[model samples]
Target: MSIQSGQSAIEILGPEQPESAAILSAQALQLVEELAERFNVRRDELLQLRLEKQAQIDNGKLPDFLPETASIRNSDWQILGIPADLQDRRVEITGPVERKMVINALNADVKVFMADFEDSLAPAWDKVVQGQANLRDAIRREIDFTHPTTGKSYALRPDPAVLIARVRGLHLDEVHLHWQGRPIAGALVDFGLYFFHNYQQLLDNGSGPYFYVPKLQSHLEARWWAEVFAYTEERFGLQPGTIKATCLIETLPAVFEMDEILYELRNNIVGLNCGRWDYIFSYIKTLRNHSDRVLPDRQAVTMEKPFLNAYSRLLIRTCHRRGALAMGGMAAFIPAKDPAKQEWVLNKVHADKELEAKNGHDGTWVAHPGLADTAMAVMDQYIGELPNQMAISRDSDAPISAQELLEPCQGEATEAGMRANIRIAVQYIEAWISGNGCVPIYGLMEDAATAEISRASIWQWIKHGTHLDNGQLVTVQLFEKMLLEELVTVREELGEARYENGRFGEASELFRSLTSAKELTDFLTLPGYQILTQKTVA
Candidate 1:
């Protein structure tokens, strides 16, 4: 199956399907083409700037608050008033935009559901296009699902949670959709397809075309999105603030420019989210060359760490100062079925959300629907009868210094943690390459962000010749040995037939190459994506 270019510059390399027809219609492709033609060059420039900034960091020029943007930070400006539907996002549940997951997430007891096309999603062509189709049906209230085995059904209940689409970051490309012989930016493809197909429907449903912009490393990247939003709004004859967005302050550099990011998108922006997993991954990647800044085991690097805490506090302070909602990070725990383990999961979630609410955050995120009630209860305890804690201006708190924001966390990297990292990364990459982005491994919902941390931590440890808790130095040979053992263990758990049929062999090779690379790879997905496309095209 194929789509004719139909005189448009964009070409669809992905196989055509009945469901993708409406999503990749000529008009929709036009919007994507125009957006790419207009903004793709700037996107390239900004991504290159990211590399240059990393080089600077590598050369001992650590990130600090920009003096030029100091005036923006010091100014007492508030973003435009958040829309009514966005005002009370006390508990937002996030998942990939699959049909059943979409229905379940919206029907959950949360206030908002972020339909993700970013980290939680592996951008295989069918999934990407079908996700847009699923969202289209969801907005129109025409979506439903039936379990193939039990014939159980799922559908949205009355007054479902508000839906916000999260587009891909700037660093990714939609290899399926090419304009002028090069792949278009994945963000534009997602934003354009979703906005073109659903904006009017969403508006008719009394909700704006909302978004969650991810992995923005600087205010300039934020500015690019602002311009795109403005162009889209005007092109469609919509009002200036008709398209609302919540930027994820998920990168190390973005923590410093929260104020400036909000300032740039003030007209259309409503809040900022603590995308903690990616932020942790960003912390390691951004400072990979700084041996002193090496992070401990992923489990040990909780939000309680001083640097992470400072980041949350600063985001809350910055967003609230400007009348924007200060959203919290994700509680990625998937509630265990075992009563005792579920108790522990809920307890952990409660403490995490409690910290966020007490820190003046207006809302928080949970990965699973089962954890919503626990998170909601905590938010209610702290912010009862309030739509949001925007009024909680933390002016009295001590100013968080740049030093605190960049402070190295202290903990041990144990052999157990190393083995866990190896297992998680290998299994996640296997799942990702097989077109499943979200997987439950060892009782937790693992996504691309967590997998990233796992692999990046290993790379950073090996790069710096760090020692494990047992006093064994981290070396490529050590990692290989553990990886081989973990694969055998995984095979035993998965059974021989399943292991042989699975992409564990490919996944293991990729993970090994990533950890053994001379330079830290930008994203595991980039390499994983190449594999996915190769398989899809074959």
Candidate 2:
């Protein structure tokens, strides 16, 4: 492998000691530099294209199936055959790339552990670099964690789940890495470093450098990743198509182009995940101009809703048609300590997974290790003795339309729902800003995407002048009043002392700024990243 660019040195602007020593070796940095030199330009161009597309949406051009990609959509094509290690993903567990969580998740009874470097992770410099070190140790089964005070130790079991790393989206930039004075794309930094260090080792262990690509907006973005995989294979002297990716159909534009996306990454992508939370956020942002698109309560927008029902069926049909796995979204519920509540949540999870399995999802996502057994049980029942449900096809009598996918829920919006949204936004953001991206709140594991949709729903409600079922108008004044009231509720919930020191004020203000701005922010994390980095530098 040779560097095509006329550069010999790679500059890492971040710290160079300790944790960085393990993952950012000279060879690994070379791979990252090569990836940046080759793909970073195209990444920037694609992000700009996203901005242009959003402008068109703002100008009343609603998102729909692309006419230009009609040939790709209508054509007969399938992605490369499913890789051996990824063929039976009955239940997949996901969490941030943290050490203790890494050891526990891998040991859980699941087929795959998607070590997320994206929404589930807070991208502080120390955390980001340390996460890479953790993943490297995990892949080698050399990971162990000791409780600082309790003196308990945690380690990987004899056999662990297959690891699939999810990198940051294209829009984020890793400021600690620079190429010719420009920040390197965070996606490249995460994917390149991980693959550079582990691809060969994984192959030696009968697996490959698998990934869960997040927040992709279109087929072109999928094509970009396909090219990246091709280039990486060449750079590392590996067989073509050794890397397998699962693109998250999280964005509205992506939902319309699922078939085209799989066609673009036919050589590298093996599955498609229904990123439900981010999908809702994308729905609100995409149709923010239309008053009818204002969503009801967040809780009311479940998988059983019409839009989601169509999305699930359509996803299953699209993936099976192309010989790819249709992975389900996260069931964020965690078992509560209260016995009655625990049973209720577990039943909910079981029902959720049952629906997916019956609808022919090959696999599903569980946010906690505890839910693995329930999810696996449901999958086992529907997919008994079968590697996957890829053979299943949609019946001729049932067909989904673009309009069904676009329709909003008929559930009523309530004042309690509004308060819950604000409460979650504040609580989740507080946890996020403090460098904890995934928080278990009210028995549910809330991540950045959950918080995003919470705030986006509020914004859409206020903008559309939506009225709650109780006859109160959802005006800016009402929202502000509710915000103040919820702040008090949050303070009381967390206690006065914890509230004072917890950055609740900062979280509240940040949530307000994002949701109340005249123009919607492309991503809540973009500004939230600034706060995290600033706090770390201080």
Candidate 3:
């Protein structure tokens, strides 16, 4: 394929050696050879490793026994962090740094653990394959995901069978490979080809690695993945249909075509992942065609009907229709601070689980290990019970107070956690206008550093009391008052962190929005004050 971006994984990562990627790839193959040389009777051995790897991924037969069912109940039993279904078979992940995250997730008794290659990884190319190689070798040797906090790891390397193998390990129920939004056939195609090229035959027969496909926007894309799988399988001398796939329903366009995508990938598809952010962004960019009105906060719209909510519902229906699992996305990276931040995060986790159960998602991805307890707690609380049929309100989407949102922490929210969000919003406004890396808002990073964080907060907060379903702020007026105060605080702290640094071409527009978030808050206080403020933004 032609290089549209003028960079492949190699050039982007800036390696130590002249050809680190090539060397790494060859080294990975050599490692497989050694494993084979050690065990492969007399062949090149990659065939054997490939066969084993492929079998692990291709194996679709889930055991017949069912773990205890999770509750859909509103009360009776409750906990925090954990989701109901998660209790049966917990799901967690690991990235480049948090090597112990997997072990920790499993040690917490989680059921599924993903060794993530996307998002969390920087993919420096030269040594990019090193981790995957290390992880795969570790898995072949049967490594366990351990919990760092408790000093406890998942079940054995050789003892009782372990379900918590490193994600993409040599052996596991699924071997999910990924690609972000890059156009080189994106992550899935690129990784899938790499997998097939590298590990087609060493794979044993009964099972094979599974693929978690992402960013697919159309039925054609799903079909294309299936076709790619077919080609890869054929090239590797494997059975024509030995691969399984999960379509990540992250983008807005993909959501619209969930049914068709599922239909296209039906037999091979195993689950649907709700990608909250990118999908929301897509909605704003797409739905504008259908409306004259402007959009609101990003988070609020996730559950909004006539658009996102419809897609979410379709997701559950489509997954269940195909006897597949429906998975929820992350709770927007919540920080781990004191009890208050923890509790606030727990609430968001609860909300996700609640929505998952309500919408029929089987499980969700808990992004951080620290939040595992929150995920687990929620699961424990609901696992033994069922939702209150009577408690199921028509206004399930009804907004609640900000205090209620942070209730688990019980008034202990530090200025950081308590005012964390509003501060970030101010920082973003300042930085966006300033065209800088990050702007300090009350001693916090608000540019790209916390842009997503701020945006996510606004998205969730806006939906608190409105049918509009966006991020909630007590009031734009109250928020503005806080914003101004934070600005003063930042200037005191940074010396150079001032509104004046916001001197970009976009500053005028950004300032207008900053004024709007505040003016709107101010107007909300006026007698019968209409929301006359121009759109103030983060």
Q: Who is ahead in lDDT, 2 or 3? A: 2
- Model 3 TM-score relative to the real fold: 0.53
lDDT of 2 by residue, 201-317 (tens): 898889999999999998899999999999998877888889999999999888999999999899998989999999999999898888877888999899998899899899999
Per-candidate Cα RMSD to the true structure, in Å, reads 1.0, 2.7, 15.9
What is the per-residue lDDT of model 1 for residues 106-189, given as tens digits with 9 covering 90 to 100?
Answer: 999999999999988999999998999999999999999999999999988989999999999999999888888788999999
* Two-way lDDT contest, 1 vs 2, winner: 1
Candidate 3 C-alpha lDDT tens digits along 386-406: 321112223344432222211
Give per-model TM-scores.
0.99, 0.97, 0.53
Local accuracy by lDDT, each model: 0.94, 0.88, 0.41
Clashing pairs in 2: none
- TM-score winner, 2 or 3: 2
- Prediction 1 global C-alpha lDDT: 0.94
Quick one: best TM-score, which candidate?
A: 1
Query: What's the residue-level lDDT of 464 in candidate 3?
Result: 40
Which 10-residue span in candidate 2 carries the lowest summed lDDT? 1-10
lDDT over C-alpha atoms for residue 169 of model 3: 16
